[model samples]
Target: MKPASSSLFALAAAALHAALIALAINGLRAGQHNVPPRRPAQVQVQLLREQPKAAEKSPATPVQPEPLPQRPVHEHKPRTIPKPKPQPREQPAAPAKTPEAPAPTAQPSPDAAPAPARSNNTAPPAPAATAPAAPVKRGVFVDPTYLATETEKWYPRQAKRYGDQGTVLLHVTVSPAGRAEKVELKKGSGYPLLDTAAIDLAKSITYRPATLDGKPVSDSFNLPVTFQLHD
Candidate 1:
């Protein structure tokens, strides 16, 4: 009996140990099933990078200016004038006249009587008649001897040189005293020297007085003087 009993006891202990291990394995499988199921692990990814933003712009306004000043103006007027004067006129003149003449008178005859004088005494007196004169007597030479001698002496020497010969006639007046009062050349000799010599000779001659009614009186007569040239 004792051996049997010990062997049975050992066997029982070994079976109790196998039973505890099977219980621990079933507890681990149950805890695993109770835990939630795990979502697939999440992964985030970017294709482009992010860019910075730009600034905004506003509008502008316009300005204005001021004005200037001004000036003034003037005016004028007009004038006047005058006029002229007048003049005068003129006139004319006249004419003149003339006068007249007188008449003629008659002459008286010699046989008619003398007319009585008018008291007014306007006529002139008649002249008286006179007597006739006595005739003159011519004179003669008292002495003809002097005539011949004086002529030869008084002959001009110039007349003789030229062979000149001529006769000069003289008018002689005699006084009652038997003297020659005047001697005038009645005719001239062709030669002047002979004529001048004859005039001188006539002045020197003597005469017999003429008798008027038987009384000695003054008288005139012609006388001739001759000049001759000789060799």
Candidate 2:
């Protein structure tokens, strides 16, 4: 090869390399202008899955109510109370066998004959010689036996043992009611104990009241009470 031809080839090759590099730069600029802007990567958000609920229960049948209590049959019936009857009191029966006696008849018999009349001269029987009706004496005098019996219990036991016997006279006033109203020692016994006992016995004694014309009257009497011991 000639040196002139080699120099011409070298110059051509350098121009072709420079044109390819400019064309590649222009294609890159067009691609940049034509391309749409890329959107940012979409973020995937996954929610937590909710657990399923238990299945709903079916509705149950309603319960029946119990029956109410019945009222007593006796309460509805009307009661009829009977009244009590009064009873009669029993009476005592009279005696059955005894009979009443008949009354006496005083009428004379119709068939009897009449008697003859008496003479006028016959003197009427003289009334039996009349005697004075003795005045009835009604008085209670002092009785020695009764007084001794009454005062025997009052005798002092010591005096009786000593064989001391004495008599006491008491002036007693008797009331109409048969009671001794007052008693005093008219003549006292020699022993004062005997005299006091005699006075008390006189006051305690009761006597029948003296009567004048059938009516009771008061009177005074002297009574002697003797305390004698048996030998």
Candidate 3:
């Protein structure tokens, strides 16, 4: 009997030990398992956006310049001139001289009216040369008183004495008033009585004075009056 009784107590102890171990292991497992507080799933967002990558700076544009201003205008003017001068005048000229004329020649006389016969007694001129002009004769004039009273005739006594025709040449110079100025006898008729008779008769005769260009001139005249006893 005693031994069975010991085995039944041992079995009861073992069951009690196993029960404690089981309780301790269950308490340890419960303590190791921790449950955090369950919150709703919350969404979180960043307040500032991340900065965008910086954009590349574009190249800068160039600028253009402006232009200048214009100027203003005005007016023009004219000019002046000069003057001229005057001239002088001229004169005239003189005249020339003239020449003289030559002399004319004489004409021949007619024989129908007979020239009174004469005896010339003047001497002839000398040479062949130019001579002075000839004297001109005067118109009809006479001294009647001298012509009548003093004339005389010739005689045969003189003719007989000379035995030739008697030449009684008387040289009588007359005055400007027609009176005999002087008488000269060149021959005595070869007889003195007849020569004296001839001279005395000639001294009383008168003649018209010789004239040259109408002026009375004094000159000598010689005449021979023949006394012939026969015709």
Candidate 4:
């Protein structure tokens, strides 16, 4: 319990605390040296490019094969042969007959010829007479006044309006009684109206019958009718 012993104990406690602090600082420095220095933090960087998409393929069309040509079929026909004909047999000929001889004529008397000599001077027979031929008749006669009157009466109105003008040939048959039996057109004009008018005029006109040997007879003759415009 003395003052000096107390003071020594205090100094020993202070020295132990300082020694522990110093040991701790040295351990910290040793740990730092043992760890390797950290290289700057390394970041791995890789460039990425997008790959292009593959092109789509179209479906292929199926090919059709062509058909082969066919050969034509032919039909065969059988041939026919003709048979030969038989020959005809020959015949024997008949014998010919002989002709008979002609008979002799009797002689004429001398007295019969003396009677014929007297007729040598007789006159020749008279000549036969021939009748004279009759006069030939001419063609039928048609009056000009009658033709003009019939033409004026039967003129077609349509033909006059169109100024149609042409001639028409006609064959007219006359009876023995001086009457028109038949009429036919032989040739035509270019205008149908004028041709029709001419035919009508010919049918209405009367003709004198033709005469042969002073007798009236039926006859046919060609007649021409003209349709001419007046003004």
Best by lDDT: 2
Global Cα lDDT for candidate 3: 0.61
The order by descending TM-score is 4, 2, 1, 3
Deviation in Å, model 3, residue 100 alpha carbon:
42
Better of 1 and 2 by lDDT: 2
Candidate 4 residue lDDT tens string, 81-133: 67767768666666666676666676677665644447578899998887888
After best superposition, candidate 3 residue 191: deviation in angstroms?
Answer: 1.2
What is the per-residue lDDT of model 1 for residues 110-141, given as tens digits with 9 covering 90 to 100?
Answer: 88999777697667777777677776555555
Which of the numbered candidates is closest to the native, going by highest TM-score?
4
Shift in Å, residue 221, candidate 1: 0.6
Collision pairs in model 2: none
| Clash totals for all candidate models | 0, 0, 0, 0
Please estimate how well model 1 matches the true structure, expressed as its whole-model Cα lDDT. 0.72
Tens-digit lDDT string for candidate 2 (1-231)? 556656666766776677667767777776889854343334333433344557877778778888889877765667788887878877878769777788888676888776678878997888888898876657766566776788988888888877778999888888999889988888977998888888888877778888887878898878888888875
Clashes of 3: 0
Q: Each candidate's root-mean-square deviation in Å? A: 48.7, 38.7, 48.6, 44.5
Greater TM-score among 1 and 2 belongs to 2
Error of 1 at 147 (Å): 1.4
